[model samples]
Target: MSHSSSDDEDTDISESEISEYEDKKYGELRNGVQNVKTSNENGTFICPYCPRKRKQDYLYKELLQHASGVGQSSSKKRKARDKANHLALVKYLEKDLMDVDVPAKDSKPTDESDPSVNSHEQFVWPWIGIVVNIPTRRTVDGRCFGESGSRLRDEYRSRGFNPVRVNGLWNHRGHSGTALVEFSKDWQGLQNALEFERAYELDHHGKKDWFANSEQKSGLYGWVARADDYKMNNIYGEHLQTMGDVQTISELIEEEARRQDKLVSNLTNIIEVKNQHLKEIEMRCHETTHKMDLVMMEKDKLVEAYNAATKKIQSTAMDMLKKISIDHEKLKLELESQKNELELRKIELENREAHNESERNRLEQEIRENAMKNTSLHMATLEHKKADENVMKLAEDQRRQKEQLHAKILHLQKQLDMKQELELEIQRLKGSLNVLKYMENDDDGADVLKKVDSLQKDLRDKEESLEDLGELNQTLITKERLSNDELQEARQALINGVKKLSSLGNIRLKRMGELDTRPFFEAIKKRHKQKEVEDRVLEMCSLWEEHLTNPDWHPFKVIMAEGKEKEIIDDDDEKLKKLKKEWGEGPYKAVVQALLEINEYNPSGRYVTTIVWNYKEGRRATLKEGVQLLLNQWKKMKKVSS
Candidate 1:
């Protein structure tokens, strides 16, 4: 709870009235009271809990005084609700500015603690008034406003103001129209000098009447401001901290005087605002009084109008009452006559109703008898119709079945004739085919299955025999000795290629050399002469020399026994690995070297063209086929856990 208005007023704060303030407490200052926000529009410390008001600009000490005074107030003051808030404010200031001590409200502390009554007010015994807009020119002497101080004093005296000192200061370099009039400690001259402000608005112009050139229509050419808008001078307009005081005797005194004068001027402005507000309220009150008088006059006229209307209504009502009485008597006579006629009509209606009821009962009895006869007749006709429909439906069903049976017999006969024709065609084809001539009768699809099984079994046997024969040839070739020189050269080349391949890790690749099985196998199988194989390979190398280096030509791929990718398998490399296992590494290396040279010579085969070939089927190998081979190998691996 706090007192929050546009400003901190000089009036007493009660607990109830202060509690009505906005919820801005010290704890809810800028960020939080813990970190006090000590800035206001004037770049000075402020009370966050108070809605800022003019003349409330405080030096840190003054604000501390306000907080501590309210926070530690006695019970009679009834400022209890704001005790915690003011206490927080004190803490906020202490924690931030590190100042000490606060004076009680309306009480005087030592001159040092109270900056208003500090050295300036105690030492400086003169009241200053600033006057402007005096006549001065470059032609005039350097004297203040080109006039002597005594002459200026004489002018102000004639105007009802006396000053102890009058000094004119330079505006720039030449004489200025401004002078500082210092009055004695007595209030007489000070009050008169201030009257320039009261009589007419005095400002920088310093003229009673302001003018376009001389400045007409302003009090003392607008210089009537009390010591430059000061009425009763107090503290300076801002904190003494901003005055650049060095705590020296003269500077401190001056700082204190400026601050005191500022306070006085601020307080005067506050009073003026309040006075203006009071005047406005009075004006509003007067307007309201006048409006009330108008309303009272209108009320009198409305009362007179109402009385006239009442008399007119009374006369019209009396005439209406007489007419109503005459009509009432006439209506009573007509009513009595009508009642006699109505009794006769009622007797006549009762006799007619009794006759009609008897006639209605007789007609209803006839209707019931006729309805029973009609119901019996309807049921008999329905039964007859149902029996006739049943007979027709049964006859129709028999006719439909007879027609269906005849059509079925015709379809069966046609099927039998087609079967006979098919048998004749089969006999003719069987007679013409030599393979079917030995076939037996009573055969079904099982016989066809039997023939296919026999063929597959024979093919499997051939493949197994071929594999075995190849192994036998490899063993025989390995048993024979190789020419030492040729063998050494081939082995050396193979060693170099392997060394290069091993040096480049999996991440980097450089491929060389090729392996061909046909020439090598032919030498082993047909000639069993290593020399023939080597010599023929040499001829093949020279033959395809141009094709090997051509980039556009790719007849063979660079393959290895194993690769990092799952599907990257070379059939030739697989065969070479097998051959090494069989005929030994020496012979396999020789064959691979000879093929590599031949492949190098082939221009069209310069670019790698991979194949999954069985020499009879030298089709280029596809990624799909390689992937399938990898999948098959994966499926065949033993299900073993490591």
Candidate 2:
């Protein structure tokens, strides 16, 4: 039923059939959006009524889409106020962004007499403020301008504006509502004064951070525009002329400077436009040169055709002379015909020369025009070089501003990410809280309590090991990057082992293993390139690497043969059978080096194998046990020697 009502409401509010209130609302929004778009360099917009997370940082188009959707939505949950805001947004988007056919209002002409453009004098720099729709200044004997400037100053000063002088105007009988205020020369005072431009009366009363929203309902509302007091200069000059005022001297000089600055700015704009036109003229000159080349090619073709025609006419004349010699009576008539043809040819040649003369005159004119354009282009290029320095200065300023904005955005993004992470953690804690409540209310609460108690006892009993584990964790954290790399390497090795269909972990053989040479013999049967012992070792290692599958084969007995260390089969009397039985039929092999270490200071010396095998399983205590065993044997030997 709610959905049906929402749909009905959506159908009822046709876009073209909005009421007076909505039309006024939409008009105000359109104006606001236009002003904002003019001022805003970045095309980022946001829904004003949305929650903080959803409201910030939307591109212009995305905001438009959102506005369109929410304005015309059939959702039952949308509030009437929210719908009004979104509809205003839709109106702004369509009229200002989509249609884009509306003409802008005419801007006021530049006021050359405004003193702020060039004045740098202390306490005399001009800054104007306009206040409108204010209540009349009331006195004991009714409305009057008795110290009205002081009252206005105190009133505005309480609300973040600090105007130095305020002139409250009056009607014929009483003080009026209009006041012209003067502000300080500093930029901050101007900024504070400008902030009052769009503020209504109620906005000044309480809404300190309010926007110029037309929907705000208030009685006797006032708004103002910040404007330059150009006529103030003329008023001062007139006062100086009549009343012997000394302030007009500096004021006139400042006004003249402002006028000069405006003139220079206009001249610079004209020069920039002239430079653009010169470049266009240069392009036209290039096009004219191309056309001249085509005309020359046409002239060359015409000259060739004329030469061919001349040869034909000469041959015809030769033939006619021969005919004249053959018949005397016919000769006269043929001669007249030949003379008529020559006259026609001469007239055609004269017409061609006249056309050539006209063409040459036109080409010469174009050449002169092109030369003039080249001179103008050179002058424009020199002027453009001057403009480039100013443009470069502006570009540098914009670049610095862009970098500041980028840093601010990065800081904001980091804060946003941190806020999101904290929110997620809070949600997780809430979920944990719910789980704890469920556990407390569960029917198996007693069993859970017992399990907790048993776990606590176990924790206490294993406190020392827990401390050791924590130390190890701290070690890993200290060298986290290196530890992570070593872990990944181990994981990759295990994956490689699995891919070869071998043991995932190194398996310890009960006895030392020997090379099962039967497969090796079969493999190297067709090979007979064993020249040096080095060659034999290379061939053996290659064969071992290529054919070996399991990774547990760490055969490392290497000895000197033919001036190179060579692997040999150790077939000692007691271990031969055991070596043959252990790794005889394994599908794995490897070639590695091993050596024995003997301690010279020991009472009873024994050689220990120094073999390095990659072990993934964490059985580290075994190394300590082996060392302890060695120490005990050394002590026994020492006791016997004593």
Candidate 3:
């Protein structure tokens, strides 16, 4: 029924506008992501909603809250409110974590009837309090913050922090500002609260006693978690039956165990995942290292190409700028030339206007002279000729002359108008030229700006690439360090294993087991030169010992006719010094001389046995010398007979 209702609700709320909202949200997210991407383009600003920005926000929230007021809850109501908020936050987090589109079910409600009565109670008892002394002195000697415990208490209270104080002042009447603190009950709660509040700064007087130093700063510090246990026992009379039922404790223990197991499992999983991630990181490091080699090669090539490109671009830009400068200079020169031409044209036009005015004055003077002479002559002729004929001819002639003058005036006016129009056209052309020059300058400026933009963009791209490479290098270094540590550990382990194996081999060798001489000889032969002296020594010893052991291996020998033992001896300063140092000049010297004489011989004839004996052997024996002594002594001695 719940599922059907949920489906119905979902159907009712399935609106198309929600999809648009989602799309808009997605677009915003994409835009944010894009902003976070290394902005190679110049003048681009990062969006405020970037992941990096979000991370900073999150960090500020977490750290600031931890550093400030959220940690200062004391009253029950405040604590409960805080816990509820915490629970709501936890639920929000869980909801985000789960992402399951389902509503949670409500569990059964417990009793809501009475406020005072306990449904089940084992016992009731009055709150007991204990007063403990915490001195303001250091016990090592007498150094402290120079404050009495009471003064410290007052300071704490003034600071709006409450601290438990002992009744009356500790250490009797000498101490002032002592306070008595009252407690309702004794438990871990009071201790926790006290410890939390005890660390603040305090203002007081007097030095601490250093002679009775304790681990705690208060020289005579002591505390107990509970002081009511003995009283409860006394009241209960040794063995009163508890009424709360054992199941409660059992359930608590079980719940605690389950929680612990879950914690352990989670921790183990976390460790395993972390280890796996470490391994993956190692593998990635290897891959990256390999790729880095290739990347380095490619990077080198790219750097070469980029450098070459940059060099070319720089050369080109310099060339372009040089051309632009030249062009600008040329444009300025052209503008100056145009200004000079315009000035010259204006001067020429002024001169032309002055000449035209002078010509007009000359023409006016000729016309005035002609009119005066004609007027005088016309009056004299008017009286002399036939009046009708003369008057008609004179009128006709006057009309024709007036018409000609009018035509000349009209022609001059048209010439003046044409000159004005020509001047106006010249001015328009000059203005057009100026406009063209400005447009050319604007084009040049725009081109230079574009080049600057391009350069800036390239620089930004290179910088971003460099930063990425740097971050990658750092990550690589971290991975390399981890690998190197692991490898070093492994190498040490291998070395230890080798040492153990060598130790085992030494133990085996020390057990007096026979060695395979054939293999030993083969190894020596293969590894050492045939003419090596050690090989010759071994061969000679083996041959001599074999020959001496065989009963049938007797050889001819010569001796001093009446042979008593005769030993040859030689000495040098070194031997004398050694003998002098090793033994005192007494009977010990004679024994040493005899031994030295025996050791210093080279025998010529031999059919010998050798016997080595300790000096403690009581037999009257002659210690022979040289190879002959060695063989003869050995021949004379038997293992059982000796």
Candidate 4:
């Protein structure tokens, strides 16, 4: 019967709890006491169950009601939410663990007594375990011992774990060399360390054991509560250890609270002392305020005095301004008069400037013309000097040739006289030889034979000498013929040079005449008929022909003529056809024939005579116009070709 009642009571309580949960709104429970005011400047009452405050104006009963209602509702909702989240996390962890494929050997159970294996499957408090190998001698110094612990702590942290404590154990013997490290309670950090270990194993596959047998070992090992430990220990061992640590932490917190209370008491004493100092300062400030009032009174009196002085000075300045205004008016009138005079002077200066500019332009044109004339004269002078030098050189050559010829003639005459004397001696010897032959019949025949032998030998020697002389004379004659040819050539060259000089001189004189007659021809153009105009044009054409035909004409003129011919032939073929149309084919053909004949004599003469005749009246202007006409005709032909 008692068991039945207990079961009924449990049923009743469960029904009541279910009813309460159903009746309460989830949004209201989560938000908590929406209508209750929590902020006020007045003294406040702090809620014990949560971090909520209310003004003192709130009734004690209302405050209690809020605490019992909304506070309980929030707590219950939070517990339910936390339970659901925990279940979800557990399911996720199970899925991850099942998916992971750990090696059979690595997953095998380790020794139960090994402290390196973490027995706890879930962490209630933040605590990680780590073991590190540290040489005993290195831990002899306190700093080295700290460094070893720090190194172990850093190794865990480097793998994304937060170490809370690092403890190093050292001994005199080298055998006891170990460090312990604790990390913050973070499941992600634990998972990362496990993942790192797994990756390290895979990366070093087929090699020596990465964790235990490496020559350059990291000397580190980490264990976390979330890690799957192969060894089994007492299931509640970590809970008991955590409880004990919590008890020790509570004691430490109480001690710290007592120390904080002592610090608060000390601060209160300091505050009280500072309050007394503040009171003294306030008293001094009041005294200073009283003195400031007196100073303000004095400042007001001085300001009134200053205002009076300012008023007097302002009056004086007003008088001075009036005088200055009058002076300004007078000065403005004077400036106006001066401006008027300046404008007149400027106009006069402008007129003078215009005259000066025109004069300068005229002077510059005259200077340019003079410079051209001077250049032509200088070239002509150079040609004259060259001609004189050539003439002197030719005369020297002629004189030398005449001297050589005279010497040769004298040598030949001497040779002829010697030959005559030898011939006469030969005749006399022959006569004596005949006389000796007659004597040979008488008894002196041997003597006569000896004499005749000597005479014959002498004749042979003489005849050999004569043969040598004859060869020499033949060579001399050949040399004389060569000299005569060379001399004739020199004389011809001299004559040609003389003719060239005379022609250049004639061209210069003719050019001067053209310059002199240019204005006269321009003046006569008004009254001249086409025939007269044609005659004048012919005269000009003849002058140009003579100039172009002269071999010694100025090099510049020759170049100009060659350029004109090339420009016409290459650029103005159509202009030649146009002339055929205007002047008739017969006259055009005649003109062309004349031009070709002139070109044969001197290449520069082509088109020279025509250009001179066409441009004689207008001189430079007509020449430019004719050139433009030719260029236009060439352009039209090019367009047609395209």
lDDT of 3 by residue, 1-642 (tens): 011122432222223343343334334333432122233433222222222443332332242233223324454444333333233332222222222122123321112243422223211111112223343444455443234547655754575445444333333233322223322222222333333223321211112222135454442222221222223343222111110112222333354468568878999998789667656655655565566467557746865775576568556755755675566557556555655655565455445533576786765664565555445445534443345455456655755665576567556544444443344333333333333333333548776555555555554555555455456457769999999899656544433333333222111111011122343344445546878846744763465345333445233233455666543332333443453454334422443332332233212222231222223442212322122333443565555476
Q: Is candidate 1 or 2 superior in TM-score?
A: 1
Please provide TM-scores, in order, for all candidate models, with all chains considered together: 0.18, 0.18, 0.15, 0.18
| TM match of model 3 to true structure | 0.15
State the weakest 10-residue window (summed lDDT) of model 3: 505-514
| lDDT per residue (tens digit) for residues 536-566 in model 4 | 6567446644643555533221224645732
Predictions in order: lDDT: 0.48, 0.48, 0.39, 0.46
Return the lDDT, model 1, position 509: 23
Per-residue lDDT value at 106 in model 2: 42
Per-residue lDDT over 1-642 for candidate 2, one digit per residue giving the tens place of the 0 to 100 score: 011123444343433444443555566665553232423456666565464454565666677778768876878777554566577666666444532121123422224355533233222224455554555556777755533667878877887777766766555556655566666433444455545544443356322322356465433232222112222443322222221112232464455568568878999998789667656655665665566567657756865786577568656755765564455435445555655655565455445533577886865665566556555655655565566556556656755775686567556555544444344334343333333333553589887566556555554545544454456456658799787788656544533333343233442111112333444443344344545544554566455434222334323356999999865544442333342454342212222111111111111222221221235452222333333444565687799999
Clashing pairs in 2: none
lDDT of 4 at 77: 36
- Best-fitting candidate, measured by TM-score? 1
Candidate 4 Cα lDDT to native: 0.46
Query: Where does candidate 4 clash, by residue pair?
Result: none
The local lDDT score (0 to 100) that residue 78 gets in candidate 2 is 71
